[model samples]
Target: MKDENIKTAARLLLGTGLIFAGISHLTFARKDFKAQVPDWVPLKIDDTVVYSGIAEITLGGALVLAPKKYKATTGKIAAAFFTAIFPGNISQYVNKRSAFGLDTDGKRFARLFFQPVLVYWALKSTGNVK
Candidate 1:
């Protein structure tokens, strides 16, 4: 596929993934998501999860529906959001808390590597990187 086509495809996929994840956060995965919240976080765990879910839904929808002129801004926001949540992922790993079947230390450790890729995806897919 051509470069723009590839980016469009990636952006669409990322948006869909986030939307689904946001839905999961509000519904079936509420408890699982709670496990991902860092213990040191002062906010109520469930409330934090809900707020993140809402943010995910809003950001995902923006990625899919925002006009071309706003793509870069949306992408930057998405990237920042990804960066913001990364500490939760680290908490999960460091605390040895398992959810979504990332039970093993290796699996949790490996998952940490994917966060940066997600950040890059948000940037690249919206043409913020190129």
Candidate 2:
């Protein structure tokens, strides 16, 4: 298949998958994910987990249904969001705990590093995006 098609498929898969995941996390991982929140952060409000879940769902929707614009804008946004969340993954690893049912060990740490790659892959599939 063509690269664009591949990228689109990947974007759709990742985006839609994350949306579902956010829904699940919002519905189920609420208390668990909240407990795992790092202590160094000062704003330990009770709403962050659900808010973050909403953000994830929004991002996933944008990625899945992005209109043609500034070359791979959606992919770039998705990638950046993954980068932003990298620290949370690290916290999970350090605490040896799972967040949102995601594994949290050596394997999880490794997976944490790949989210950026997924974003890049989706962008690169477009072949014309920067």
Candidate 3:
């Protein structure tokens, strides 16, 4: 029961964070987010940011509201979403784009490691892992 409670709290926290991030992507952080978009992506940087923002909002809502039966599936999807955006983190590091105060190469490199943690968070928070 305690473990369940912990998972619940973690899930809620992750969901809320994602929602906030999504909003920032569409508004205040839009420009900053563009710095992460890889040059290889065909879409305009703005469009990619907007689309990803929308996705984050949707996934966040799912994580927050999904029923027990759906939580695992939602977690899996969220993990995939995190994985999908990983290249953007890589782009920020490789291209030397400074945003979110990741001005130093070491900082950007460190940020890359956080993506996997997010994936694990999504899974573990939803009880996808023991």
Candidate 4:
């Protein structure tokens, strides 16, 4: 069906985006990513960034390569991952640590709203929602 096809495309795009982001976290954007790590987190900021980068890469791979029967499970995991990382976004805003062009409080605050959209996208694209 047309709807299914659309979902498929969206899922692929999300997966690819995640992969790209993960790469950035480990490489070119590593310092920018550290800006998002909350001070309360115990790990060294660089370590946190690296670990999260790996997680993102794994989740992205799962989203792209998960079999049809496992799509919903992958979706749930992806959604949870998105939820887990939300605090980093909050940290970026609260600490006034600018990254990804969210240089102002208003922009950082607005970026907070996008996390839920990613959650929804993960679920919907994998057919975990109608």
Candidate 5:
């Protein structure tokens, strides 16, 4: 397959994952998500989760439906979004908060490695990266 086809497939997959995760954030998994919120965040944990949920939904939809002409810009925004959320992941690790089966120090530490992958995925999947 061609590179563009791969990118399109990746973009769709990332968008779907985000949509599912966003829904979970607002619904069944909300309480669990709160565990990931950093103590340093100024807002209430619940509020932070809700706002991030909304952001995920919006960004995911954009990734799925954005015109080809705007893919790069959308990808840039998505990458930035991923960067913005790195703190929560770090908090989850640093605070040793257990959620989503990341109960052990090794698991939590390993999970930290995935953030940059997500950021790269967002950029590469939308043609923002060469």
Candidate 6:
């Protein structure tokens, strides 16, 4: 496969993940997903999680289904989408909650630390950053 095709496939995978996660959050596991939100947050926790989930799924669908002609924009949207949800990852660690049965203190930072790399990947592939 060409480099562009490979990048497109990876972008699709990112979108796929968001779609699956959003579906889970909007469907059967919203409360569990919200459990990670810190009490200090001002908004209604349930509303926040559910809304975020919906947004994620919508953006994910856009990314995955986006035509090859729109890969650049779609990738940027996916990258920004991922960046936005990152705080939830932090909330999970702070609340001592597991996201998908893999939640643990040691594992928390391990995953959280990759925010930069994810961001970079998103930027480089999507042309958001040099």
Best by TM-score: 3
Question: Which parts of model 2 have CA positions greater than 4 angstroms off?
Answer: 99-104, 125-130
Per-model CA lDDT versus the true structure: 0.94, 0.69, 0.96, 0.95, 0.92, 0.75
TM-score, cand. 2 vs. native? 0.77
Q: Relative to the unseen true structure, what is the C-alpha lDDT of residue 68 in candidate 6, on a scale of 0 to 100?
A: 63
Candidate 2 local Cα displacement, residue 111, angstroms: 3.3
Best by lDDT: 3
**Candidate 5 clashes between residue pairs 3 or more apart in a chain or in different chains:** none
lDDT of 3 by residue, 42-97 (tens): 99999999999999999999999988899999999999999999999999999999
Error (Å) of candidate 2 at residue 58 is 0.7
- Candidate 2 backbone collisions, by pair: none
Each model's backbone clash number: 0, 0, 0, 0, 0, 0
lDDT of each residue in 52-94, candidate 1, tens digit only? 9999999999999999999989999999999999999999999
Question: Candidate 4 at 36: error in angstroms?
Answer: 0.3
What C-alpha root-mean-square deviation, in Å, does candidate 3 show against the real structure? 0.5
User: What ranges in model 4 sit over 4 Å off?
Assistant: none
lDDT of 2 by residue, 43-128 (tens): 65356667778888998888776676743776676777777666666777787776555664766577667766766765664343
Ranked by TM-score, the better of candidates 3 and 5 is 3
- Candidate 3's C-alpha runs over 4 A off are none
If scored against the real structure, what TM-score would every candidate get? 0.97, 0.77, 0.99, 0.98, 0.97, 0.79
Ranking by lDDT: 3, 4, 1, 5, 6, 2
Model 1 residue 16 lDDT score: 83
Clashes of 5: 0
Residues 1-130, candidate 5: write the lDDT tens digits: 5999999999999988898899999999998899999998999999999999999998899999989999999889989998999988899999999999999999999999999999999999998789
